[model samples]
Target: MTRESWRTRLGFILAAVGSAVGLGNVWRFPWMTAENGGSAFLVVYLAIILLVGVPGLLAEFVIGRRSQRNPAGALYRLSSGSKSWGAVGLFGVVTAVVLLSFYSVVGGWILRYFLASFTGGYFGSPGQYFGAIDFGLPAVGFHVGFLALTALVVVGGIRDGIERATKVMMPAIIVLLIALAGWAVTRPGAGAGLSFYLDFDGTYLRANFFDVLGAAAGQALFTLSLGVGTMITYASYLGDDHNLASDGSLIAVLNTGVGVLAGLVVFPLLFATVGELTGPAAAGGGPGALFVSLAGAFSQLPFGQPLAVVFFGVIVLAALSSSISMLEIPVAYLVDEFGLERRTATAALTCLVLVTGSANALNPGLFGFVAGTLVDLMLTAGLAGFLVFVGWVLGKDAVTEFSSGAGSRVRSLGPAWLWSVRTILPLFLLGTLAVNLLALAGVSLF
Candidate 1:
């Protein structure tokens, strides 16, 4: 069979943006901002996206396009049959599975809430409702439902599946989010939420600099969908005529912009109903804070049921978009490396994740460990390995790949970009990994 490619450049861009703009943007970004000095964390995180995230994205793009292969195939082929580099690609394949295990569980929750909205299922005491339904056999069922949706699309292959789905899903996601954000802003006393989110808190930044930096760095990488070879896998499908640097920058900017937009929708709704941010609601920055607070906000508002439908509907699209990308990494590996049929690849991996994700849905402790700390460590390590490969192994050849379809301006920055990927960037990623590990171990290195 011949290799499949995206039918249009917009399809690739939309799919890239879809992969980047996931639960991280809508769920994690607000929580991370609230947990670590609010606006100050936002500023630092934005800087990291530009400096670290974009360069890392380019490094992945170069590898994928040059090799035109999956992460494991790309590394093994690029290195002339070196097992050591192949190990890095193998690591990415594993990380992708680990990611989907927990991610599919969360996607399940979002889908349940989306369906519930149409029927006013959780309108009475939304916080208690979330507490009741967050985990158990019901969560397992929902997780299966979400994973099934993801598998269905990916089974269709690249052109007939991912590219076509994102072309429709991406537009619907943006339109619905914009409408929700606009409605959220017009709520009574929304000014407070906007101020709290946007106002710079310099004192907090200075006092918790290292803590904030670690959070910002982790979030920057997570929000961009880096470190998992997702970008590399997608770029492998690219034709030589596409400009990766420009596309990479555009994806970064759009993802960040959507994150800011999500914050506008979430924070204002929380403040509008809850009167003010307080205690765990402010400090705990993840699914718990998001589901409870947003549920409460919706329950108290007129026309909220429909609005809930729209809100969670957008989240469903966003989550599916990202989850599909995660699943694609391993499927691509199977097809590219072992010559499995695309449907066979998708089915095999989907079966693997169904069990893994169900385990996460059944246990809170395992879910927390895998979804929070384990994922951060794995992604940080994975991206660092990718950068080192680009910098040390691929080096000049990496530069050549980067300049392949880039224009004059992007081409001009190739050397400096390659330099950063080689030296400072790997050290920076290593520092990030160390800080996170210390924090996990209660070492307080920062």
Candidate 2:
């Protein structure tokens, strides 16, 4: 059978952006900013995105388009059919599962909050409302529902499933977020929210450079969906005629814009309504901070219920768009490596994630650990492995793929990019990985 290919360049770009823009951008970016040093973290994060994230993205694209296979197979075949390279690809497969295991739990939270928005269900007591529904049987049930939805789409195969779904989803997501962000900015005390989010504080950054740098790097990668083979997998579906460098840059640009837009909506709403920028929401709020906090904010506004529906509905689309990408990794692995049909592979992996996601729903501490630190470590290490493989194994071949179809400007930068990818990027990734691991180990040497 012929390999699958994207129906259009635009479709591939939207699908890639859809994968990049998720709860990580909407929920986690705001929280991480608030937790770290507000705009200081944002500044550093932007720097890292330009410096590390974009180049890393290009590296992945070079690998994917050059080999045109699943990560494991791509690595093995491209590296003289080496088993070790294939093993690195398998690590990416594992990273995908780990990413979705906790991601589904958050998706479920968005689902529940979307439903609750119908009647201001959690209006009077946001804290109790969140705590009541956060984890346990109901959360697990919802997580399963979300996971099932992801599986159904992925099981349908790429064109009919991922492409078709994201085509509809991506536009709706953009419109809803624009509407919500507009409305949020118009709220009373919206100025405070804007101030909190946009206000620059270089002093804060100067005082806590490494701390903020570490966080910004993680959030930047997380927000862009970098380091994971998601970019590679998505790029693998592209035809040779596509301009990989151009497409990758557009995906990065679109995803970053959406993330910034999400922050525009989220930060304003939080400050205007909750009076607390960082930390947990009022008593009704818990793990899924954005859902709880934003629902509460919308509940207090005019036509809040309908707006709430629109808001949560957008979030649902965003989450599913991303979740489908997560499921695709393992699904691709099974189909390419194990010879399973797309439907069969998706079914098996969905069942696996069901149990894993349910475990996250039923346990808050475990969920937090996995979603936060564990995911950071896994993606960091996974990306590190990829950069090394591209820099060392593929070497000149990676540069050839990068320069192909690239404009003269982008093509000229290829050699420098290759050099950095081979040396500095891998070292930086490894160092960050170590710091993250030690921090998780309760022994922060940094």
Candidate 3:
């Protein structure tokens, strides 16, 4: 059987951007921003994306394009058949599964909202509606429905499925979001929300530096779709003519733009309706809170039913785009390592996620732990492993791969990029990981 590759550079870029810009941008980014001092979190998040996210992304690309294999195979082959390093790659594949298990439940929630918008089902009492449906048989039913939608696309193969779908979804998401943002900023009380999002607070940033740093770093990795081998899996489909640095940089920029745009829509809607940025409705209640808050906001606005339809529709697309990437990671592993057909691999994994995601949908405590703390730790640790392999295992060869298919200016930064991956990046990631683990254990470092 022949392996599939993306048909065009444009297709690969769009697919990558789609992978990066998902519910992480639309849902989690706003919640994290609101919880972590708003603009203060934004400042640290942007810095991490620039300094850590891009470099970490390129490391995965180097491993993928060089080996032209899934994350496990890439690491194994690159390290001259080292089972240990290959296990690290396999860990990434597991992280993707963990990601989708919770992520699909949220996707289901978005789907319910998208459908309900047309009928204004939740408009009367958004909070009660969410509380009733958030965990139970209804959540499970929607999760399965959402998982089915994700499976439908992945079974289509690279060009015919993932690439083609993202090309359409990415553009629609951007245009709709811009339209929404345009409308949102014009609302009666939007300026307060905008001020909260855009205005910097240096004192808050400094005082909560460690706490914010840990949260910001996790959000940065999560938003970029790093550390789960999604980037590595996606890049494995690339052709050599594509420039890794330029492509990676563009993905980061586009992903960050979408995240900021989501906040513009979310925060303004919150302030425009609720008139404040605190409490469970604003940020505290996690994913469930965000849904209730937005649903209530849409109910209060004029033409809100139509606007809710459009807003939830964008989220449905964004959710599918990211869910497909997460599903693709494990599917790629099965195909590359076990020689399973794509359809068979996708079918098997879809069933697995149906069970796991149902557990998330039915249990709030499990969902919160997996979605918030566990994901952050896994992604941080996963990225750190990939960077160490790139720096120590691949070494100079990693630099060569990083320099492939690039202009003179991009090529010049290869050594520095490699050096950082080898030293600075690993240290930073480990520090971040330690902070997160400490936080998880109820120990405050600051």
Name the top lDDT candidate: 3
Cα deviation at 380, candidate 3, in Å, is: 0.5
Question: Per-model C-alpha lDDT, please?
Answer: 0.90, 0.83, 0.92
lDDT of 1 by residue, 206-298 (tens): 999988888898898888889999999999999888888999999998889999999989888888877675422563445677887787788
Pairs in steric clash, model 3: none
Better of 1 and 3 by lDDT: 3
The deviation in Å at residue 326 for candidate 3 is 0.5
Candidate numbers, best TM-score first, in rank order:
3, 1, 2
Error of 1 at 304 (Å): 0.8
Clashing pairs in 2: 126-284, 127-283, 127-284, 127-285, 128-284
Please, what is the TM-score per model?
Answer: 0.98, 0.96, 0.98
- Per-residue lDDT of 1-446 in model 2, one digit per residue for the tens? 56688887778888888998888777777777776777787778888888898889988888788877778888888888889888988888888999999999889988888888788788887767888998999999999999999988888777888899999999999888888888889878778777766789888888898899888988888877776788888888877677777887788888877888887888777777767633333423335666566766776678878888888888899999999998898888788877888878888998899998888888889998888888888889888999998888888888888888767897788889889999999999999998887887799675
Q: Assess the local accuracy of residue 380 in candidate 3 as a C-alpha lDDT between 0 and 100.
A: 92
